[model samples]
Target: MVLAVKGTEQEELQSRDRAPQSATVSPTTGFFFTSPYRSLSTQGCFAKITQPAADGDNLQGAFQQGVQQAFAQARQAGVTNPVLCGAIPFDTRQPSALFIPQQTQWFERQAFMASVKPTLAALPTIVRQSELPKQTQFMQMVADAVQVTGGEQLEKVVLSRLLDIETSKQIDPHALMMRIIAQNPQGFHFHVPLNEGALVGASPELLLRMCGSQFHSNPLAGSARREADPLQDRQAGERLLVSSKDRHEHQIVTAGMRQVLHGRCRHLHIPAVPELLSTPTLWHLSTPIDGEVADRAENALSLACLLHPTPALCGTPMLAARELIAQLEPFERGLFGGIVGWCDAEGNGEWVVTIRCGTVKANQVRLFAGAGIVPDSSPQAEWHETGTKLSTMLRAFGLQG
Candidate 1:
């Protein structure tokens, strides 16, 4: 992901090996963050008066305006070319928690991550782990999603479940993020502060990215668990690549993306077929879509507001799918399925689907994972799929997931 840098770009990214000071301090210092970062990002609070819109029903319009306001405020505070980084909630009406960093320094993700691998002072011991919907209830939830039409012929719904873990000690946000990155070493990694707790995870799905007038997205919908044997894992990936049910699910997402981008893009490129993508725990059906926007007038956050909850994250015919999700899932999604990434004042940035993540607050950690349910979805299979997704965060807590 190449960034569309504006000014002092090369000097800044290159001068750091002669820079004034390290701006690579963990995002733990001031405010929190959301989305995935192809590069490390840190942002302070949005200058007090710049809180986002919390109306819950508006699309990206109002929130985009709020972010523009925040950037203007940042300039007033004398912060040069300030960038906003943080989490946006799954529900649109909720406010986005983004901020302009007091300082910005870009890091080549691989090389910088290589120089840091510190461990947690202590990993929290789990006292109890409870699934919100439980196994049977989650299966039923999937079944319900499969059956519901929301008064329309629903093609798909992204159903999610929560795992609430009570720990023996307080969880350190910084330590947990470090552990997740060290163990997995993939996806868009972030640790952002919320009103109470912090949002952290390594997300593998790219929701959308903007570099100048160019944009790219990698949406993943279908998945299978990885196997211990290399040959078995390879076979599993191959099977997933050709799975009929999985392909239908994956197509819904790519279709939804095309629908949104069609009117806005001057040229779009999407493969006729999807390929396989793998993380540490699962194999996924992934399609890479890229194009040039008709105009460079919109910034990253503003453009992302239009494509936040793609069918992969939510479902096809987003409105109907959202209605079904609200009626089924027991917990508020908060920022879990929302957008996570950073956008400079220029709107050149990257955001990953906020999957493979959880929220940490004191002794309690809530992990979330979801599965895309089409009419042909199986309850039992969807149950196992979500569990495989949870394994990413569970491993960070030093648990074998």
Candidate 2:
């Protein structure tokens, strides 16, 4: 939904490859564009601070300032409805610090649901692929980069191409988002898991969303999906728990989180053990961390920003992994591995790591998946790992591949 602001000039801010529609807003105000890039976004102007982290470095203050600046700048230049989103990066590994207020029945007092009739153009049927280099070329470049960075010798990098197909159906983006929320009221949902390919349910985690002072976030560290056969499902959970490679990957993610949250929060609870968590297709060794903010210096989204590019989504020894990723992969990640969520005036919101997802367009849909590559990583296995992840998104779009 395009917003019309009462301003004259428009700022040509950032890149155009973003998820469609999803917005964040305060209860008193209407909806606003939460991020400059929505789904397939990566090139927006991101501010990175040098840090052991600071109290004042947060999303709430930045957003409040951003709103003021946007409107003020608009008035000066004569622009209207300046679409924007603010992100904060915190180095914590716990459940999101954002709190989302309970949606009481009174808030739903009216039959506010309305049909979203879209006059979308006829979507084209097309198959597209990212230009990835050969496995050997990719690995050699990664190895060389790791050596230069004074890091451990790099392992293999997992890569997968999505065979995405588009249908002419115009689904209600917002209603689908709300449906996820209503179904999983007790957990994080509405993550905008794109409807294309094998991925169906967008999320069981709320990356970020807000209503007044409340913020909500659920960062999933582990995953396991229930299999049709009960015994097999149990075996998969066990596999995720005991596999050294998987455990090693999860540890990198969890430890990075601990480093980020150290002094920023209170009543912080870190679990010493990990449990098995499952989705429909796979199982993950999962650990859920929760804590409260002591400084009120940062809002949940800002904190989430710090945790962006975690080892789970990215790879371990972040610098090393990122560098290696740049060398090994042929296409830009865009927003495939970025953050997705919503925020409001007070800076309260949630954002989720963009993973297990895809990008939808008129001509084609691109599915993305990656896995941690370690010494023991097998190229074939890593290939299958990504394939499993891609299936979920395909299911959502009513497509099978």
Candidate 3:
């Protein structure tokens, strides 16, 4: 434990472990976050973290060690089987907004949802609306990405768009989360309270999950808007299934995923063809990959950091895709494409891709969604895809695209 350090050395590590700085939800003291499988609700702060999380493959400052430091401090504070939960930024180099909760409870999916009845309550009226890059600019960014991908230097890049709305009153996050879950009941729903606002979403992609010796990930790419009519919807999915360009975009993600998993896992399984997954607004090509960890010490966060910014989230040839995303994107992603979940002392947790999500503050909400761009990608189609993606949250607010 870090307790062995003496004098100024101990003070330094302790300073790095201070509680996360956060503002309260309008009325609640803590936060509530969830995955498709379970929910984590925290009442107050315990020993929190100040260190930047998971410094790449460098185990010295990565998840396993970070957890040991955090949980060890939790034990000293008299907490039992404590868990750290919060949002990890898209960039690993940034400081992590994680904290050990003084009071933490885990709930089964059905039980938690059963208690949260869907609400018909009207959210605050949106008095103003704005887009980050504007439609034309976003399309041009996609076109540029397409041209870059058409070359050998880059294969694919995922770009995102933002829609900011100012409401007549502060939004009730719990009610909004309920509406979101009611629409996409099977997705990963989360609401993590932050210093300014709350990071909330219902993500369909599982970044990583670990239970005992095994781990699993479901990476999604290539999508088509879901039509209201049954026949057209099926047709849309079928077309996406047969699209050479979409398949190529999807394979780039799977290939990057396999490479990362192969280095830390054994008995890997990734199906050759991706299956279609349907949400209320779109259909996605998804691959369910599973395997046993080669290293017993691999916690959920460690593995997640290693495989993070997957081509599905970032783009292929990871670094180049990121550089381009930074250049073309009008704003910083913050936690948009990162992860939101929790891990306990046992090193098991679920981290879902932060998609179909938004940042909810007093009287406002910022929604985020991204589309993967490939050589044959159409900027207009990409625009529509992202709009459909954003609708998952917009509909929750009783607003339509």
Query: Which candidate wins on TM-score?
Result: 3
Error of 2 at 95 (Å): 26
The stretch of ten residues in a row with the least summed lDDT in candidate 2 is: 100-109
Q: Which ranges of candidate 2 are over 4 A from the true structure?
A: 1-201, 204-226
Candidate 1, residue 81: lDDT: 72
Query: Ten consecutive residues with minimal summed lDDT in candidate 3?
Result: 1-10
> What's the CA error at residue 63 for candidate 2, in Å?
7.6
RMSD of 2: 9.8
Mind giving the per-residue lDDT tens digits that candidate 1 earns over 130-184?
9989999999998888777333668899999999999999987778877887876
Ranking by TM-score: 3, 1, 2
Query: Compared with the true structure, what per-residue lDDT tens digits does model 3 show for residues 1-401?
Result: 12221122232222212433232222134556666666666666665564665463445665457668878776665565767778888776676667776766555676666666678688888899899989999999999999999999899999999999999988887778778878888888777878788888889999888887798899999999989899999999999999998999999999999987887776899999999998888899999999998888778878888888899999989899999999999999988898878877877888888899999899888999999999999999899999999999999888986
**Prediction 3 global C-alpha lDDT:** 0.80
Question: Which pairs clash (backbone N, Cα, C closer than 3 Å) in model 3?
Answer: none
Q: State the local distance difference test value for candidate 1.
A: 0.76
Given candidate 3, what's the lDDT at residue 367?
A: 93
The TM-score that candidate 3 achieves is 0.91
What's the alpha carbon RMSD for model 1? 5.4
Clash tally for model 1: 12
RMSD of each: 5.4, 9.8, 5.3
